[model samples]
Target chain A: MTEEPKPRRLTPKGRATRDRIIEAATELIARNGVAGTGIEDVRAAAGVSGSQLYHYFDSKQALIRAVITRQADSVLHPDQPRVTALDSFDALRAWADAAIERQRENGCRGDCTLGSLAGELSVSDEESRTDLATGFLRWKDLILDGLRAMRDRGGLRADADLDELALSLLTALQGGVLLSQTMLHVRPLEAAMNASLAYVHSFATTAGR
Target chain B: MTEEPKPRRLTPKGRATRDRIIEAATELIARNGVAGTGIEDVRAAAGVSGSQLYHYFDSKQALIRAVITRQADSVLHPDQPRVTALDSFDALRAWADAAIERQRENGCRGDCTLGSLAGELSVSDEESRTDLATGFLRWKDLILDGLRAMRDRGGLRADADLDELALSLLTALQGGVLLSQTMLHVRPLEAAMNASLAYVHSFATTAGR
Candidate 1:
């Protein structure tokens, strides 16, 4: 006879086991890649087994989506509160510096969590792609809000291309991460940030008019 | 008993088969990722069975290197003779414009042939990583040469940091492509190219001196 399914919501003990699986999955995914790391590997790393993993995730896709969603909340939302609070160029530059420093700590190998995930999976892998897309857009939205606030405060050009600048910042950040990782140095990251800061500030300065 | 290898240096037919396999594998790797793709998929796509696929490359890693090598040649050494041979601000902008056009045509979804492999594969995938690293350095060296030439000819700034500029240009291009692909649009790529072209040209102008 088919075993009855557990309740849609997990019991406390069941929840703990699921959390362990994802925790293990995160490290493995960061190193070995999402597709490269199998459920068995995740379960074993979490000190669980095949039965335990299947019970929690039901499928690999479910586990992947959960991992991405978890990363989204933890990473994309943590610094979000600061966006509204940033009203000056120094604050934005400081944020960039902090981002580069964190990436340096990671050996500049993996800055964009969503970017790493997107790299390993099919861009059309709808389940995972959606999560990555959401995370990126969320990041863009927050940064745009900060720029808009600055604009309102008369700290930015009224004609500043918010959307374009936001995208440029993202592209430069991603590019910097790649270059840093590839060269095993932070110089590229620094150069990109310096140039980007200059470019953005070029628009912010009223004297440029 | 081990069967005697039939002059396994790859006959023309075998070479053709090998090229087909590499081409198919590269496309699949770009779409599904190197980790997610398999020999079976490459063979099927190339219309060859498993044995035929194995006859050329001893392993998947070998095939990956070949693909990376191919992409390196395609990206850094396009068939059209040496537009980079000419050194002028207008020439640089024209080349940048052409590159942007290429991205626009593809909708910017495809990853850089060298870069996708580098970012997705592990650093410990030494053989392929080394192949990629060599390719990037070589391409950068070519760009560096071009910039140095421009400087010598008084087309660019005498004291311009050519290395930084070339690295930034490459990084920005990749980043711009990544953004365009994620959003399924062209505005990001256009802005990145435009800004980069402007930045580079500003440095190249005599007024900057």
Candidate 2:
């Protein structure tokens, strides 16, 4: 397992600079892809010196891994509590709606931040692939927690395969988001999430209802 | 609409050279993505002179378009008839199986060739995005044909929303395949296809059964 290099403690100003570098790299990569965006491009975009970049990240791969982490953080941070506290079908629907709304707000141009990176970086780099997979697993775990909560609350059938259901929902979201991004429409994402929710609903108990 | 450049009639040797260039570019782009793979790289990989490259393709965008067309063809060629002739539920299952087997054979490294390109190329290039959307529509249309056949044959309910179901299935597939590729496992794909088939099954009439 390749661990990310730990950064030394830095001044508050240095922390801001590091954050700027990451944000700039994320934008560049989100637009041009990992292989397409070079270190120079990131440097120019972030307005950081070469040494400054080195001060933060040891190498390009490390920076990319950090980007993946950052993207995952961005996705989870806003909805972390709601996502984990998904105790009802209504809560699940709300989460799905927010995702669709976010895509619409962005013109449905870019896919899930982690998904876009995964599609490009997964094939070539092992460390990056592992990081991405871990990132997805984190996302999955959150939804899984919600599903389990629903089960515990007598919302889902005892026989419901929560793990499979969770994975299916995530798969649906990834696929829906990809098509929506490519087609520049929200219909596909809406359809996918609907299907996934319906799948979960299939295992609903009377008590849950 | 931007039209593909018309090729002057080529001798057999010229045709082979053109094909060689396309194949090389496809491979390179598949590995490194569109923005990462340069004209010079394709030229070297294909062992063609700069003049030869320019003669065959007016620009790098032209070659990438050709590659997209080629990838679309590759996907449609083997299963085109079967996919369109999805006259039975068994046939639909067979199609799903074939897709999963193909992914397994490739070790789940490359996703739907066109899908991978769409994820990277869709944002930056309008022409490529349109071409890719067209390609996906073609794929969806084939599945739609199959579903319609089932409905007509009384296998599905008359009121079944074939278009929404088809789009949902395709979205499920894109998501499933994307996850499978990223995780290097076929489970996500399998789960997605299973859910899609089940969705179709839900609308099946007694006669269809």
**Residue B62 CA error for candidate 2 (Å)?**
1.6
Worst 10 residues of 1 chain B by lDDT: B1-10
> For candidate 1, lDDT tens digit of each residue in A80-180?
54444445678678777876787788886544365556555535465566666676677677668877887887878898898877766666766667656
lDDT of 1 by residue, B139-190 (tens): 6776677788888878787777888777766666666665566666777666
Candidate 2, residues A130-153, lDDT tens digits: the string is 888888788888788889989988
Each candidate's clash count: 0, 2
Which 10-residue window of candidate 2 chain B scores lowest in summed lDDT? B75-84
Where does candidate 1 clash, by residue pair?
none
In model 2, residue pairs whose N, Cα or C atoms come closer than 3 Å (at least 3 residues apart or on different chains), thus clashing, are A175-B175, B155-B208
Error of 1 at B172 (Å): 1.2
What is the fnat of candidate 2? 0.51
